[model samples]
Target: MARSKPATLKDVAALANVSRATAARALNSYGYVGDETAQKVQAAAGKLGYRGNRLAQALRSGQLPIVGCILGDIQNPFFARIAHDIEVLARECGYNLVIGSSEEELGQEVSLLASLRSLSIRGFIVAPTSADNNAHLQGLIAENVPLILIDRVAEGVDCDSVVVDNEGGAHKAVEYLIAMGHRRIGLLQDDMRIFTSRERMTGYRTALGAAGIAPDERMIAVSQSTVEHAVDATIRLFSQKTPPTALFTVDSLMTQGALLAFRSMGISIPHNVSLIGFDDFNLATFTDPQITVVSQPVSEIGRAAARLLFDRLSGKTDAPQKLRFETKLIVRGSVSRRG
Candidate 1:
């Protein structure tokens, strides 16, 4: 079989019956092309399956034309969606995304970051593994790398960050349950070592304090990012002497665990135990009672983080920014009053 030639700018121009400069003007939005002409050029480009050579362009401009995105875990729906949005926005901005996932392992994250540096990717959007990895992050900053932390922020590591307000989101979720008259609420937290987990736990505690409900250590369970661990934790929480009336899970895995435990134990949702979770998932709406959750702007956060990194690479040297987006509690069938 004969190999196909990659479509070029010339192919698009030739198919559009216009000069190369005119086609470039239309495609690059450089100005002076009529609407009809622009449409024709775009149609021809589409027909020819034309794509600009971003690498070559970047070489000419002395930049990589690629953004490095380091995700905490690709298995999580939250991170997967963020990666998809980052790629979409990077393409829209005339750039490409090089994605990597750490799976919550420290050494692997450092290795991937170092490789990206060796590949000359000076711009990054990362959801770091732990706050303990400050030195590794500081090295990137010292190298003048434009870094934006997403979802999880490293402690003592100064850089641009885009995150949903974890504490505030947790507080709202808990408060929603409280208003429904559930005094005994359980918390299923991610590994306590993770920054978001710690912040969320703090939020949960703060909400209990405000509600005049004493915090119960026995009602809280912490686990790694595994369904098995989460399920075990949920079981422990529910098996306590004074079982909680409702459960608040911090992440998608924990939510699944809590739900699975409910199913296995023959406990009906919102009747035996109400549930609320962070980071909405597709299955959240389709379950027996649609899960009530605090919805975060995952795609928006991803795009904003990428934009921040791009701005830094473009020589915008204002102080590092910390962007905190709000989360909203989506009341659904899963949460109800304790009768």
Candidate 2:
């Protein structure tokens, strides 16, 4: 069987008894055309089932009805929520959303951005993998592309961003643990190249310094932002002869990993080792002792970033908006008072 060819604009023009230029103007409603001529073009198009090529039209106009999103890790619930919110807003604005995950790799991020740029996507929302090393992002700014940094920001990429107060949140969590008389504290964090990880580490160090506790390199563990890796890192941290009385995890997945590690090692939460994490997860309260965490405005971050991109798409040429939302410490049974 032979595949029938789809109808084209030239066919519609010939059937309408008009030039291709005139037919284009009539079908697109751009230039002035007589009512009878437009009706004729419409009739001809309907008869031939001439569905115009959207990609070809977009290339001619230099804009596509699509928004690209690159997140750190789609498997993480935090990123998943943000992606969902952005997709919802994109749909409401009559734009399709294309999503990719960097997986915390700078090379992958650069490659993904280049691929999306080749498609002439209208705008982008990205959670950069590295705080520095972002020449690819700078290229977008140079090209006047609509880009919004979400969750994380890159160095010298002066674009609109939506991030939470990571330093403040970490400081609050550590300070609370200190108030409970936990002098030896541990940190399970992502790679230091990540903006949020660096900020949270700073907060941890500053809080310890303020409490007259010397910073100990043995107390810190770096791991990729995944449950499996965090489990290994947690086990290593706790296996030391003298471990921290309390621990702080940078994200929810790591927090869950710590819980699993403790369970496997015959250690108990709040009784054996107090705990606090940066982001809240769905199962935070489902455990025996509810997990304490610093909760950010995950629901608002994505929607705000999407709105900023849409504004730029609509020709709003204002100053780049840097939105930083506050984080709240949700105290639960995970942390216990220690001497």
Candidate 3:
């Protein structure tokens, strides 16, 4: 069905028998009008189905009032969820969003940023590629552009960032597994090139050290963004002569790959190999043996990132702020003490 065009200020003015300027002033909240008269104008505008032209207002103001959102690997549930929340919040604040995905490639990320710049986007919220491209990020910073990095932030990149407490979360996850009497634990981590992954690795080691368990480099597997990489790493860890009694994955995808590898190898959760992961997945509870996880406040992170960007756009730039949110250890059926 074809949609009807929205009624304009002129239509409302004709209905209300007031001047166009009076109708606009009432709609835009710009000027004082008699109480009863304002109500009459509002009722007439509502009856006429008038809607404000935001695009025209933006054009006149020379501000698109949009935030450029560039994410890495939109296929990942984590990224997709973040993008969804960002879009919802942007709309609520009377700002539109321009979204792009980099597919975890540095060149694609660079191109996406350039494309957004060409469109005159005043701000960006990005999940950059794990690989270091400090120069590209620094270039944006140098231009005094408002940028808020989420999930991952680069070293020496002086900008506001919203990140989970990766190290603390990992440490708590491993500590919980250790408390459950799992001494030989396997760590399935992402590419250590990223700062968050490195911090998680350190946390894993910290847990083992605090427990007086020797750090076994052999037990740690370096996985990438893909499920194949995670699966391969898990296979290597489980194939050891004395396999780990429990598994801990750094992220949701790695957790899924770990579960798949266990299924393929006919290993029973908890009975054969207890499992826990860092990031929460949508179907974590639906699995036969529900996976335990360190749950991050993803929506809150997105909201924080947007709020930071909005503040900067509102001219609140003073010093770069790095915000980290706490995580929760969600206990499910995935982990148990070794028999």
Could you tell me every candidate's TM-score relative to the true structure? 0.81, 0.95, 0.82
lDDT by residue (tens digit), candidate 3, 98-158: 8888877788888889988876677999887764766778888999989999999987689
Judged by whole-model lDDT over C-alpha atoms, candidate 1 comes out at 0.87
Q: List the residue pairs that clash in candidate 2.
A: none
Worst 10 residues of 3 by lDDT: 54-63
Off by over 4 Å in 1: 1-63
Candidate 2 Cα errors over 4 Å, as ranges? 1-3
Stronger candidate by TM-score (1 vs 2): 2
**Ranking, TM-score, top scorer first:** 2, 3, 1
All candidates' lDDT scores?
Answer: 0.87, 0.94, 0.86
> Compared with the true structure, what per-residue lDDT tens digits does model 1 show for residues 119-139?
777588888888776677888
**lDDT: which candidate is best?**
2
Model 2 C-alpha RMSD to native: 1.7
> Model 3 segments beyond 4 Å from truth?
1-62
Candidate 1 lDDT at 293 equals 93
Ranking by lDDT: 2, 1, 3
lDDT of 2 by residue, 69-131 (tens): 999878899999999999999999989999998888899999999999999998999999999
